[model samples]
Target: MGVRGLQGFVGSTCPHICTVVNFRELAEHHRSKYPGCTPTVVVDAMCCLRYWYTPESWVCGGQWREYFSALRDFVDSFASVGIKLVFFFDGMVEQGKRNEWVKRRLKNNREISRIFHYIRSHREQPGRNMFFIPSGLAIFTRFALKTLGQETLCSLKEADYEVASYGLQYNCLGILGEDTDYLIYDTCPYFSISELCLESLETIMLCREKLCESLGLCVADLPLLACLLGNDIIPEGMFESFRFKCLSSYTSVKENFDKKGNIILAVSDHISKVLHLHQGEKKLEEMLPLGPNRALFYKGVASYLLPGQSSPWFFQKPKGLIMLDKQVISMSSDPESKQGVPICTEPESKQEVPTCAHPEIKQQLPVETDSDFNLEVPMYAHPKIKEDKPMDMDSEIKQQVTLVSDPEILKVARMHHIQAESYLVYSIVSSGEIECSNTLEDELDQALPSQAFVYRPVRQRVYTLLLGSCRDDISASLAVKEWFVYPGNPLRHPDLVRPLPMIIPGGTPSLKSLWLNQEPAVQARRLDALLACFNLSSSRDELLAVESPLRALCCLLIYLFVQVDTLCLEDLHAFVAQALCLQGRSTAQLVDLQLEYISPRAVQLGSLLVRGLTTLALVNSACGFPWKTSEFMPWNVFDGKLFHLKYLQSEKGYSVEALLEQNRSWLTRFHNLKAVVCKACMKENRRIVGRGHWSSHHTGRWGRQGSSSHRTSSSCGHSGQGQPWRDQGPGSRTHEHDQWRRY
Candidate 1:
């Protein structure tokens, strides 16, 4: 957005002209040259503090205070050197940039969440980790500036524009920030904080004159180049097609436009020509795309160069100037008050004053009475005007009194003049003293009738034939054993009750005595059915011989499925052991083995099994299935699978394992290499080989040296000197080589 790659490109291209100098050195220079004069610098406070407020810096142990303290010391150092530092903090984002602001806010929230997670996981004393809440950091900065007796301007929109505009209005020394947009605004000087060094504290001033000269373009055409380079309001894609194809042509047009003094028109025409050539005349006819507010994107680009004009997006002039002194700081209360009031003094009178001794002249003044003037009406006037108007006024007042005396007349009068009466009624009602005919509570009671209470019994006794046929000597008992056998009298006949038929024959056997008493053939059939349910074809002896925990776990899972029972940890371990031919293995060891054998395929199977079981459980539960029957349902199978997958992927996934193996192989190969050659050289050669081998590489290197020597000899000969090329001083040759390197 900020002229993509402009800062780096400028620094690299003009490193000699754009030399780095410490801020302290500049302050010293200003103080020594202009003894009593103080150079004021407008600072983009918000932009400068972004690096300090990062999660790594501000989210740890009292860093907010420490950061501001450092900032305070920086401001104080400049103040000591007779440089007035004015800080400008950003305010609400302008309407045009609200979309960008929203995205930034979302990014900030993400950063905050990340910081919180890090502190909770990594810090032993997380409760001590603290920083300024939400907007408190900016407020703290403002407070710090105030304490330092520095004037701080809180911008109404963007601080960048305000900083630039204020610097120009005051003719300050320079504008300081990290923003690259300042390069386009060539008015006043600009410096980037990132270019400053902590050890040297150098400030690299952006030289607009050198930049324009180097680029072969004027200051006015820089914004157009920036537009093509891309900015916040203009998408990079808009000019991406022409960037490589027509950039040189555009630059040439700008450089050759000295014949036509209008640079803007020349650049615009050149752009249209290039577009038509590349995109066709039909595409060129279409209007350029605009910003969100329908402002031409080009206008926003050029607005940076024009000082007084504000861009529809991004830039806006600050409302007023911020000023400060030793005792107090103040800004212009009104933006319209551009001029200062003039002080006036009393002037001496030229005429002589009248004293008491000159009473004769004082008494010559004349006086007048009210009766000296006369008024009259013509005969063409109406009769009412001719007569006294007091009678008519009295008659109208009497009619108003009569209307006020009757409620119906008053109501009709109020309705006829609602606008006048409404204010009076609202005022009275708001005063909270209006009396009503009935209270709200009484009205509510009258509107709603009370309900009466009634009672009825919910239970009724029933007489049955079974109750009458019950034998004597057997007291009725609700115990399950009593229903199956006679009460603890061995001599008494046992009660014979018919058993409920099994819903599905050869289903999974219950882990109870009744199932254990079944014939061996029936038990084998049940075991086979359980194994078949899980798609396992192995016999009991084979399963026991393998003793694989995965198979045992699968068997336990199938048993829960066939019996419609919820899974429990203890029951799972016990059944899994039983499936392993009742092997004597600890639950922990079995669990470890089960986890080791879980593959991606096993995960998919477990996920599907869990999903189907959960669905069946929910359906049966909803259809009035007894809660006692399925209390051990395997509802946590999904959670177990998810945990396993996350652990494996995060800790030992196949991709990660492969990457680790490749790194290990590289390390081993590096260690086995001979010590004579440098690893960096080897790496370079490896990269070069990928591009393709070069033939006669030594010849290419020697040829470059030979050409340089030839040029040096020719220059020496032209100077009428017979000196050899090597005879030149080392420093001079080194400087020549440096220049060649730049080229």
Candidate 2:
């Protein structure tokens, strides 16, 4: 996190330190400074994700197509002005920051609770003001960037560190992001992504030199000043005693920063007096409140420090990972040890930050014994160790085969189309942990199970299948710790999962086996495994016969049908309509329609589909990405507005033909998918009924056409005089869901 209250502190300084200017104008100014040089800015992808999608961002999972379309517009604007942006994202959790991570996650969870509460209390969906970032956005965004052919990197260390380092090393114009930490770094000027006025291409930027000048300190003093005010490594409340003294020592500043500004100014003044004096340990304790480790202050400040020169890895891309002479940082289980410094040491010119990837990262993999998701690691997958690079290279290198798994895994992942998820799959494979980001949805609405939670069974199976490799040696880093999302009280820990093995038709194969073999027989077996996951093992031939364009779509629908505990004809039929809408001009039409209100049911269903899409992406990753990456585009396949509209039409009793009346061409493909979905469910439900797991009374609910009476009484809670199929079997509706909003 950035210095606490620094945004306010900088805002108080106004035009001197921070000012709003057209982004193009700023780029032009930089170009003038460099004469003949192109203006390139290193963008913080995390910050962009938070600020970019405004005014209906994650209201119903996401409007991926539109979101991406808008993202392209922003990028095109940058290009239109001759500004090149290189985006960076974070990966691999830092030990010291877990608490901060948990705190932020819980805070987002509170917003989730509030959004649904507002809906339950008001009987209408909340307005555009509620902000929450959903999961898979980063992966999705990376995909979007790839389509645009933008250069991007997901650091094995931290994105912020890499971003600042890249900017300073390359002598870029500045770093653009909202993170307060950018202010603490003495590298390039920092611009606020939040202050971006997309229409005019204007954004607010902070002049660090001016900020330091106004505060009466040197640029070198910024990090210490930020620490004194509190940061991620240092809590703001940790300086209560110092804060009290600062408040008493100075009167309120004449600036507009208010009380926080007064304290900041006071701290700066105090720093000026003791700047040289606190070089000694005794003087430091006398001047500041610090923990036992004064070195932590150094480390926190050092986290912002950039290497004297850029790493060789950035330039070694296609040439492959060359061994660096410097020792790579160890990912120790003891995080404190990694952050520990015996004494504060300042870096001189030519010093380099420790790289994070290590040789032992490939030493071995450990999987849960008797794992619930029955998957065995593929030991037979042969990979060649590079003859060009040294025997030891960073696991991050694209082709350097480690003692870990197949080189093919990395080769496939490095493809331009799928590189966005490169870190996600790599982290899971290398570290056995997945650092989940914020996924916005109506968790508070009990009408549906938490979408994330609902998918755990799927994920657990995925983890086992992906991480199921057998390695003789296992390390602490290999222990499974997945960042999870669910209802109250867990407080952001990676919730434990007890996965069960899924029985594939021709027996499960190693992840390596999934990718290496491409025989018709092998491909058929892989397809059968995918079908078996959705309870459609018997209909393999039918799925195989589907047109390739509709194959992924059919798999998604069938997956949704299998995953959801219960289903209905209306919901299932609407799913086809939504999928059909993607293949036509409907998304463009949706862009023109103003959808002010969407019922909770539509949001839930749409959110579930989006979640399903991401899960399938994860599945594809686990199975070595047999499907094309383009098949996963949320924008092409999913539009939240379009989904909600179709849902409302279905709720109002519109037939499939009527729902597609605007584009009747969809009717043919629509029924084809409908027949496939109904057949898939019918086969699966027969098995459920045979096992006595589902009641015979509701067997018609998933029948070929789903009799009109069955449609009237299905699990989507279209209330009628009949019991409906539920996960717990035929049951009465739990509660009346307000399907329509109050006008």
Candidate 3:
């Protein structure tokens, strides 16, 4: 291997002391963990590892390679756990590392020799497995990794990490020259190449714990921690300002690489406000260095990742179906500049136009004459408008015309001109009750009316405006009710200014509307502000916009956590026995909120109760809960302290088999709907995972397919899995030995 560009640097060398020391340390540690277990570790790289790791000049490069080869053989002596030395060329990764790498030098070589040397023979090295994963070097590393069988890697990673954990689980000793940000999955454990030790497993564990503690996280949280710190662990929390500074500092733009290595979006020119660079002009070509600017490039990426403050808050309230408030009127003729703000000032206060006394506020203020105009506009110019009168300033201006020549005096005159103009008013309304003109007198007074309103002959019409809409859009309405407010978004008329996610009909109601009713979404938002709250958006008027099953599941999960009450008996059982199981072990811990106070013994008893109840529900057709059974009932049920499932069946003739069939049908349908989504995803891309529908890319596609699968699956499937129920014995014996323990 020859050193080309920056690869001639020290890092490109074959095996430096630290690299040897680190790998040696890790090898020894693995030996201790599995006394006789010697795992043959492979060096997987997209290119020749020696080319990237070894320097151009070495005191004993051949000897070091021999040492690594020997280490592989020694590890394989007991049990050969083969590792693939796979190399992938990612263009983005390459581009990111361009400045750091030495230039490549092409050399003409015999085709047969090159092919045999680089591929067939070398890939099948003795005692060590090597795989050259086909990939473009210019693409992102994530793309290369994805192509390398994510599902297989995910499974293996999970297993390896679990085996290394302290108790029943395994942990991993992460080793990679690449950035730690690559680990986003919950199970992946990350350690620097230096962290892995060769002595005992304790070194690995200690390193893992120390890293976790330094990051203010648990051992399990390393993946998330890595995502935030970015590469090579620069001082924490520096990523924020780094992006801003980068964008401001540099003006060069790089070409965009797609998932494949093709250049999808070309960088026509670099545009920057700081340097005053413009599009379609190579202004920065002369100013910027020809090579990659690492600091500047990284900062630009950080800026893109950093979202504006308003975007998060804009979606805080899922105002179902955005309706404009007609009450707010802007005096500015420009519609683009005109915006609606919350009505904070009294209507009467806006009647009198105020003059600005302060020069700074006057100069910055929009041309709104009214004092209350500041409430609607984003910028406020006048500070002392209450004390200053435009007419008085004008009168003095006429008396002392010579003062007009002064710049400060001229600015005051400009303020007076603005004060003379009329300002627009934006009015907002709260809830006002309205009655349907066709509603029957008898049905009008009832709290929960099931039937539509019927028109009465010779009856006076009754109706009221609930919440006023913005003048621009009259079709949308914000109606406040005793419990909740409904904002209707007519799909035909999308609020141009604010884009909202369509509410899935039968999905959870809009969070803002729920706020009026104290719904779980609102409760959860209060508990965790980062939680997605509902907002008014397009596609509001559909009679049935059924949310996809996965969306429904998320909705329910959010509801369960947000709701003050513990999960309902049936839901809790289904969540634990089925939902948690589907989520794998990592997320199962998320539902362990209730485990802390209760004893492990008590928990096992409760889990049994939950399991039995879930099993009973699965098997019974009567839809009767197991807690309803007298034998397994908790003593507190008699005292009315614990939860009790409310019975649905009235007749004694109700069959347990029937209830189980019904409940299981519901669960089966839910699963089947999920399956439909999974199948739909596979249809588009055969390689896509069954769980891909849950991914951000496929969420919209799955949602649009809608309720049909759920309805059909719900009605059609028989409760096959739910039918085989063996009672796990009565509660007292099981309650004595609790199993579910809290963290």
Identify the candidate with maximal TM-score: 2
Cα RMSD, each candidate: 39.1, 10.0, 27.3
lDDT of each: 0.35, 0.59, 0.23
Each model's TM-score? 0.35, 0.77, 0.19
- Candidate 1 TM-score, true structure as reference: 0.35
lDDT of 2 by residue, 509-548 (tens): 7766776776666665666555544445677776766766
Residue 100 error for model 3, in Å?
A: 13
Error of 1 at 327 (Å): 36
Cα lDDT tens digits, model 1, 468-528, are 1123333132111111100111212211211111222344333221123455555454444
Better of 2 and 3 by TM-score: 2
lDDT head-to-head 1 vs 2, winner:
2
Cα lDDT of candidate 3 equals 0.23
* Model 3, span 651-695: residue lDDT tens: 122233332334654555445433433343233232222222234
Q: After superposition, how far is residue 127 of candidate 1 from its true place, in Å?
A: 19
State the displacement of the C-alpha of residue 380, model 3, in Å, after optimal TM-score superposition: 35
Q: What shift in Å separates residue 576 of candidate 1 from its native position after superposition? A: 55
